[model samples]
Structures are given as structure tokens and as C-alpha cells.
Target: MGVRIQMLVALTSLLALFPSLTVTVAVMSVDLGSEWMKMAIVKPGVPMEIVLNRESRRKTPTVVCLKENERLFGDSALGVSVKNPKTVYRHLQSLLGKKHDNLQVKVYQRCFPEHQLQGHPVRGTVYFNSSLETHYSPEELLGMMLNYSRGLAQDFAEQPIKDTVITVPAFLTRQSEGQSCMLHRWQV
Candidate 1:
């Protein structure tokens, strides 16, 4: 009983010292990289904690698979890449906001020759071509990934986490492309 009282007093003192540490709701942050994505969550009475995926991994591969009518994300999608190279999309962060003629897009094309990538007829930007005969823009693909990450965060928090912050790769931010989505005003 004495230890419990002391612990409560310490917690109260700590909360008084750092008011922000007393979080009442859960919030999540995602680091969306080219090869992997990591998520962290902050909840009441807890410090920032890495949100693990279903596989209990701190990070998830940044890959998505779109086959027929089904779509897969992360490792599940990566697992199917060897069998269906044309349907699985990898390193999508590199393709984000790139033009069809951009040097980066050229590099992406060379990296994944198995999949067909074409310029959007109107946007003149990169669009992925899969066996589904449907074209998906990088923005759409990134949105799907963000959604996937949200699911992971939600599962870990065990509550609906509506507040989320997503950050892109450093290279993406330091790129010379000015006509791209830098996410300065974009909110998750």
C-alpha cells in the first residue's frame, strides 16, 4: 500500500512536470519510406511506442499487390511478387509525384521492367500498368499505402486513431522536382 501511494505520487509529479506526457487519446505517426514503413503511436500514460504489424515486426515492406479483384499490402504483397511480378508494385514512393519523362521515372522504369508503366494521358505523369488492364497513379497507390498503415495503427492502438502524421523519405523532400506533392499543405 505504501509503494502504490508512492508510485501514484511520482506519476502525479511527472504529469505535472510534463503535461504533454499525459496523453488522453492515441495518435500515430508513419514514416513512409521507399523500402519500408514504420509506425509509432502515443497513447495515454504511454511514451511513444512503435506500432508493430500483424507479423509483430516494427516495419513493413513498402509493396502492394493488385491482382484481379483483390489487393494486398506489405509482406503479403511482397510474397506474391515472385509469382506475379507484373501485378505487384514495389518502391512506389520513388514513383510518387514523378512525371513520365522525369529522370527518376526513367530509373524506376529500368528498375522494374517486368511491369508496364506509362504516362497519364492527361496528367502526363507516371501510371502503373498491371495485368488488371487498369492504370493506377502514384498518388492513388500512396493513398492505398497510407490506408494500409492506418489499419496497422488502428489494430495496435485498439481504438480508432483518426489523428495521424505521415512523413516521406528525405530524398523525396530534398528532390529538385518543384511540381510534385511535397505534402507541405497535405494532411493525413
Candidate 2:
């Protein structure tokens, strides 16, 4: 009878020691490449390290497609490019800097700025809109990619995020590159 009572007490104590674990869902975004973005939700109440990636219905691509028919496609454009390499564009981060007027940007050709301000050269391609009236700037283009990723996070959680963190490389600096921006404006 004593042993039975001790076993019951031990089981009750064990149950009290460790309660059931509940995890919350939080959206997390990661820059897979400079151009591509990935987003997933992390379990809440746990450190940011515990988040697992939820497979997306579509893997977003940075590339955008313009057709003579005035039809446009972004991520889906990649699949159609193998047959016609001339219509595909990739790795536009290299063309973000100033370029010489004589520079000719061709379809499927990587665009690069003629001048290299810092150690990192600015490179990106300019894409044409359906209206053919406006040209997209490299900075603006890249910003759209970033915003898209943020949207993914917001959409998954169905809530706005107050606490956010962005990861940048050690060498990415506007000061070293002689570019004037928020990073350069602040004298760190």
C-alpha cells in the first residue's frame, strides 16, 4: 500500500513539473539571395531560432516578365525562359549604380553601373512597364522585392509586425561607397 501511494505521488509530481507546451505562430522572413526572398512562421514564445519554414504554394522569383501582348508575369516567367533565354532576366543587384549613357542594356543581359563608388559595384537592370512610360530604378526595384517578402510575413500571420530585424553584410556601407543615405547620414 505504501509503494502504491508513493508511485501515485511520484506520477502527480512529474505531471506538475512539466506541463503541456504550447507554441505561438510568428512570421519570419529571410533573404535567400540578394534578389530572392523566403518567408516562414516561427513558433511563438520560443527564441527566433525555433521557427520552421512552411512550404509555400509558389517559390517567388525576383524576375519579372514583359510580353509584347502586354501580359506580365513575375515568378512564373522563369519556367518559360528556358525555351527563350532572350526573354529572361536574372541577378539584377549588380546594376544599381550610375551608368554611362553609351551603355546599352539588352534583354537577358546583366546590367552594371559604369562607375564603382565603393568596393561593391552597383548593378541592376531596368525593366519596362506595360505603359512603356516609366522606368524602374534599381533602388526602387530592390525595394519592391523586399516589400514583397514583408507582405508574405504579414499575410501569413494576418497581423502587422512591430518588432522587425533586417540582416545586412559587414561590408555593405553607403559611407565606404560615397553614397548618401540613412546609413551614411548617421555618423556611426
Candidate 3:
């Protein structure tokens, strides 16, 4: 976090030298991990800091539980998952972009054994049969998580975060990386 702050400070200083130019920007970086995800921001006028979740934690559990009509994320979702595992989705980064029958996804399914994993007959990607009997693709679930992360970052920065760099697992296929809105982004 300090590393980005150094560069951001320089940018702000340059702006100070030139009072005629007005520019404001904030960049967020996300580490999309299987077990936990972290977020940080580089915004002018303040030191770069890790974005905190609702619980004010540095890192949030990579979990989401859709219980009936209510939705939960991070620690709250993990707590609900303990009782209603079927409504919870975990290891989202690991499952994204992999074939439904891929060995890695198979291991995840066998290890978790909470939600029912099935392959889309056409897409051949993995989707979970939630407790509500809704079929949710990994990409869709990940999008929810990313949206949640975006909210956290935006709230912390106190402004809209337009440019974000999300770091993905090295093992993810190109398709998985492409699934997100990353036309001008990359993993790591």
C-alpha cells in the first residue's frame, strides 16, 4: 500500500505545482483469492490504504450466501454458510473459467460437498444449484463478489472507482480472465 502512495504523492505534488490543471482519480486493486480477498486504493489527497469491509477488516472471506431473498457477503456469509451451506458459494476464484468436469473443480466439489455442482450442457462451465433451486454460474457469482468489492472500495475512497486492477490466479484459463470486464486489465 505504501508503494502506491509514494507514486500517488508525487502525482499530487505535480498537480500542486500546476494549479491550473485539475485532475482527480483513484485506482483500486483487488486480490481475488479462493479463501479471502483484499482491496486497496490509491487516491490523491490521502494515503493509500486497504479498503475495509463492513466489519472493518483488512481482508474479507471470499464467500457469499444467498439465503432466500436476502444476500450476504464476506464474514456474514461465512457465518450463515455454517448452518446453510447450500446457500453459500466459496472458492469462487478457483472455480471460474474451468471446465465443469475439470480435475481442479472436481477436487473443489469433493472437498466442499455443500452445493451441487453441474455443468451447462452448452457452455460446459460449472454452475451451482443453490438452496433456492437457482442455477448460478461461477462467473455470475464472481460478478456479485466483484460488485461487492467495488462497493467497499467506493465507500472507502468516498468516490467512484473507475479503474481497477484485479489480480487473478495464475492457473486461471484465458477464458476465465476474459469473463470479467477486463478489456484493459490483466492478472497480477
Top lDDT model: 3
Q: How accurate is candidate 1 locally (lDDT)?
A: 0.77
Q: Model 1, 1-188: lDDT tens per residue?
A: 99999999999998888757444668889887789999999887788999898789998998888888898999999899889888888887777667788898888889888878888888777888764557777777766777788788878888777677667767664332222223322234
Residue-level lDDT tens digits of model 3 in 123-165: 8878887635578888877777887888899999988888878
Alpha-carbon runs more than 4 Å astray in model 1: 1-24, 131-133, 173-186
Per-residue lDDT over 1-188 for candidate 2, one digit per residue giving the tens place of the 0 to 100 score: 99999999999999889966754445454443445544454546544432222334444566544344442234565665656544444454444453432144332233423212221134432443323354444444445444555556666665654333344334334422222122213121
Worst ten in a row by lDDT for model 3? 179-188
How displaced is residue 19 in candidate 1, in Å? 21
Deviation from native of the Cα of residue 130 in model 3, angstroms: 2.2
TM-score of 2: 0.46
The lDDT for every candidate, in the order shown, is: 0.77, 0.44, 0.82
Query: Over 4 Å off in model 2, which ranges?
Result: 1-28, 40-60, 66-74, 80-89, 101-132, 168-188
Instruction: Identify the superior model by TM-score, candidate 1 or candidate 2.
Output: 1
| Residue-level lDDT for 60 in candidate 1 | 95
Off by over 4 Å in 3: 1-23, 131-133, 182-188
